[model samples]
Target: MNASTALLAAAEGGIIGDGRTGANLALGAGALGMAIGWLALARAGGGISTGNVRTGGMAAIAVGTVCTVLAVLHLATASGGPGTGNGLVGAIVAVPLGLGAVLLGRRALTRCRRADRPADRMTV
Candidate 1:
């Protein structure tokens, strides 16, 4: 299982030693780590197939895109002005995560297509 899924399962099982707060922290960290992991995989030219790595990368991209958009909306609605650090940090992190996911997905799709192609036959 991926980091996010494993963390979520652990949270559901109450496996975190620090209770709900710890579970929340674990989930958050797992999500971020998953995103980073996917990006690294993509950059490293891994997960070119329709495998777990590719699926994870796509999921990461979706989550990252959503997170980035939500962060932007939150920042826009914040009356405390643009100096709020949380929104800024979220924006900075999410965009790259989303872009990396998209890239990995594209790479996987391309590889899958290439693998499915039939080899040329001899005319003799």
Candidate 2:
């Protein structure tokens, strides 16, 4: 299939079993993005020193955006409410998780930029 169609199918859980699959996938992605963002923020703040904080922040932002989009798509396409096995609750929860990730990533990015500037330079 084409790119758009394939993405829609993937977001819809691959045309397979129940609707929960998409929600679960979105939840997992959001959690992963949040974790990455947290680690990046820590690294930027000097709490960790093993990786590049800027790269981690960018990755977190991208993944978080994707997670939010997937969750929204699932919510839009879901057929039932909270108790009908449609994963409405999971999608609802994922929204904040994804936004949290984005916020953390942005914080880390700002820290990275602040650290990169040369505060001691003369403005001649």
Pull out the clashing pairs in model 1.
none
Q: Write candidate 1's Cα lDDT for 1-124 as tens digits.
A: 7975554434333344422332233335435645554554654354443345445545655554544443334334323333443234443344454455456555544554454557674232
The root-mean-square deviation over C-alpha atoms between each candidate and the true structure, in angstroms, is 9.2, 2.6
Question: Which 10 consecutive residues of model 1 have the lowest summed lDDT?
Answer: 18-27
TM-score of 2: 0.91
**What TM-score does each of the candidates earn?**
0.44, 0.91
Q: Write the per-residue lDDT of candidate 2 for residues 99-122, one digit (tens) a residue.
A: 989999999999998888898862
Best by TM-score: 2
| Predicted structure 1: clash tally | 0
Worst 10 residues of 2 by lDDT: 6-15
